[model samples]
Target: MSDFLQQVVIGVQLGSIYALIALGYTMVYGVLRLINFAHGDVFMVGAFVGFYAARALKLEEQPTLAGALITLLPVLLLAMVACAVLGLVIERLAYRPLRRAPRLTALITAIGVSLFLENAGQLLFGADPKFFPSVTPQGAGATLNLGGATISKDQLVLVVAAALLMAVLWYIVQRTRIGRAMRAVSHDADAAALMGINTDTVIAFTFGLGAALAGAGGMLFAALTYAKILPLMGIAIGLKAFVAAVVGGIGSIPGAMLGGLLMGLSESFVRGSGFSRWTEAVAFVLLIGVLLLRPAGLLGRFAPEKV
Candidate 1:
């Protein structure tokens, strides 16, 4: 039972990160109906940004609670802002011109952009992996044992922070004016434009918003879970998040969250079962199973295309 509980905690922690990244995928798809393949690389960029920010701030040198708080907050904000700007730039320069082109054209361009970012990351940050500095204060909150399962303060912080971000996102989507315009554009860009909504602006905002979430996920993953940073790190994680989005219903925010949790739990249980080698493959297996059983995903609605 303790073992089971431990896996659950670990699963939820991992799920939270996946959920953050998956939200980006779902949001962009919701508005543009286009998958931004470079999103994971954007996540990678966020992690790097956080890494540099932490170093510049000399966070590792300060081991006090106040120092940790200062380090964590600033690093997160900096990563998010930088990624958001990158997202806007990508939308303006790479995707906007292809908006009216065939879907295939946009998709290919997305792939091209992904490759460009990956190579650019290598050129700029080098192909070697860098260690991410710790932002959690020493001995802060210690490790708590819950029902024979132990969890660190960092993990707790990661989960709570993710939840807060998700809540903010939900509010923006359900209650804000920009969110309404986003929804309108998603439903029908032409109609939204006719209704006097700025479709282009909404679309760009969607990209920026999604990218910002991905950035947060990147920072959290680096600071809390894995401390290794690399240029190509986003490739695998991005694919998994993309799988989560597909499994949750590509354009549904709630679906993306559910899918991310499910993916994380599934992977955790697989590792716990002593099949760590299969951990990476499990995401795709779950995706295939979901598609076979429910093509629209666990929470997604299927809409028939007009011929």
Candidate 2:
């Protein structure tokens, strides 16, 4: 029971990170039906931003709750803003022009953008790895233990923060006017525009939102386990999150969150049971299984096509 609880807690913590990153995948797919392969690199950029900020501010050498928060606050804001702008630019410069082209064309463009960003990032941030300062205060790792299961402060923070962010996203998507426009655009961009909705603006905003979320996830991930920010960091994580989005039902906001959590937990269990090598394989196997069993995904419903 203790071991089970431990794995569950760890799984939730990691899953929360995946959930945040998965939002980027689902949001872009929902709005534009385009997979922003570059999103993972946007996450990588955020990590580097946080890394430099921490170093410049001497955060690691002088650790305090207030100090860490203050140092991070500005860095996170800047990273989000930067990534959002990048997302908008990518949409406008690379994707919009190809909107009328074949779906394969758009996909190829996304892959190109992904490659460009990775090489550009390597040049800008250097091919060498940058170290991230420890944001989790000392002893925080031993702060909580229940029934022989320890819940580090980092895990608690990740879970609670992710839950809060998801709640806000749910409210925005389900209740807000902008969200309604987003849904309309997602359903049919042409019809939405004919009805006076600015589909272009909606799509841009969707990319911005997704990029910002990915940026935050990147920062959190760096704080948790990663210290080095590489241009290619997003590739593996982004791919996994994409799988999670598909597993939960692509284009379903809630489904992305659920799928991310499930993927993380599944991977965690596999690792805890002495099958660490299968972690990556498990995600793909699950994705293929889900696709085979339910082509539409767990939360996705089939929609009738217009004649």
Candidate 3:
């Protein structure tokens, strides 16, 4: 029972990071029907931004609670802002021009953008892995015992922070005026534009918002889970998050969250079962299973396309 609980905690922690990234995938697909393959690279950029910001602020030198908060807040905000701007630039330059073009054109351009970011990141940040500064004062060994299971402070902080961000996102999507416009655009771009909503603005905003979430996820993953950052790091993580989005029924916010949790739990349990070698393959297996069983995903509804 304790082992089960322990795995559950670990799963939730991992799932939170996946959820953040998956949200971006779902949102972009919803609004533009274009999968921004470079999104994961955007996530990588966020981690690097956070890494540099932490170093610039000398965050690692101060381990106190107050110091950690100071380091965390600014670094997170900066990463999100930088990624958001990058997302806008990508949209305006790479995607907007091809908006009316064939879907395959936009997709290939997305892949091209992804490759460009990866190579550019390698050039600018170096291909070497960099150590991420810890925001919490607690040492890595520090953990609390609950019901015979141990949970790290970092994991607790990460879960809470992720929940807060998700809540904020839910509020923005469900209550804000711009959010309504986004939904309108997603439903029917031509109709939304005819109804006086600027589809282009909504599309750009969706990209920026999704990229900001991915940025936050990147920072959290680096600071809390991985403790390292590299130019190529986003590749695997991004792929897994993409799987999560697909499994959760791409374009559905709640489905993305559920899918992320499921993917994390599956990976965690597989590792705990002494099949750690199979952990990497678990995502693809689950994705394949979901695709076979429910083509629209666990929470996604299938819609017939108009001929």
Worst 10 residues of 2 by lDDT: 61-70
Each model's C-alpha lDDT?
Answer: 0.90, 0.82, 0.90
lDDT of 2: 0.82
lDDT (tens digit, per residue) of candidate 3 on 1-307: 9999999999999999889999999999999988889999999999999899888887763556556666688889999999999999999999999989999999999999999999999999998999886667766555889998999877888888889989999999999999999988888788899999989999999999999999999988888775679998889888888999999999999999999999899989999999999997888989999999999999987867644
Stretches of candidate 3 exceeding 4 Å from the true structure: 61-67
Candidate with better lDDT, 1 vs 2: 1
- For each candidate in turn, the TM-score is 0.97, 0.94, 0.96
Q: Model 2, 1-307: lDDT tens per residue?
A: 9899999998888788788888888888887888888888888877777677667767663255556555667777777787788888988999989988988899999999999989998888888877777765766433588898887766776687678878877787789989899989888888999999988899988988888888878877776665567888888888888888889988888889989999989988999999999999888999999999988788976666555
Q: Pick out the ten consecutive residues of candidate 3 with the lowest summed lDDT.
A: 61-70
In the order shown, the candidates' Cα RMSDs to the true structure are 1.4, 1.8, 1.4
lDDT of 3: 0.90
lDDT (Cα, tens digit) per residue for candidate 1, span 130-230: 87776676464657899999888778889999999999999998899999998888787788999999888999999999999999999989887756899
